[model samples]
Target: MKDVVDRIRESPKLPNPYHIGEICVLLPKDNPDLRGKAGYWGVVSHVGDYSCTVQTWDGDYTVKIEHLKLLELLDEDCQFMQQLCVRLRQLHQVASRDSSVDWLLQGLGKQAKPYLSSLQAKLLAAVEREYKLVWKQPKQN
Candidate 1:
């Protein structure tokens, strides 16, 4: 039994199969730090031998390749997700600094659906406006 356990521990890890720009869902069962982020999707920003940096709505997280499940989406859908990621990141930053509004922002961050309904999007915008969380568009050069 001891020898078997040792052999298992010594076994080589599998190569990472994911690539940058790919979308993947987080599998947090094995990672305590990601406990509340299970099923959350993100874009792969960087890939290493065993782990990759995933840019989610809330933040960037470096997780093992085994902890991700790839999402097969159309190019347009991926573009939409990338835009949503930026919006969520801005919202998360605002919520982190304001304790009173953190609950609402956190709830939005927890949404697992890839698409938000029109009504939901409008409501989110309203909340952003009410809380002065809107992000200004950068001027083109």
Candidate 2:
């Protein structure tokens, strides 16, 4: 009787590449298309096989982990940013009160539509200022 042996080959697994909303750097040493984009940072919007899609200042791109570096923000700054986000969310809840406003939105309650709009604009501006991106509003009829 001949002896037979079976061997299973298992490939090493990589950890999670990145989380959504994470800011990562691009190292374009090998890709000519990203040659000058090495220094810029982008937000990781989606992750794929050995690659991730990021939204940058100029555009979005799918890059590999080898060419992506995670940005480590200071603890204090990170905490502050988190708090700012929470505050902005609270500010957004202000919109629910809009339904009870006067016909022209200049009513006795809801702080008036104009004031509420101003508050939202300010909150959105703060978020944009910290994140270096603008919140584009949908077109109105």
- Runs in model 2 with CA error above 4 Å? 1-9, 74-141
Quality of model 1 by C-alpha lDDT = 0.76
Question: Which residue pairs of candidate 2 clash?
Answer: none
Query: Clash pairs of candidate 1?
Result: none
User: Ten residues in a row with the worst lDDT in model 1?
Assistant: 95-104
Give candidate 1's total backbone clashes.
0
> Which has the greatest lDDT?
1
Q: In order, how many clashes per candidate?
A: 0, 0
TM-score of each: 0.72, 0.47
Model 1 CA lDDT for position 74? 74
Model 1 lDDT tens row, 1-141? 999999988999777898888788899977997888887888889999989999987789999888998888776676666667777677677644556445655655556456788876886677678668765544545
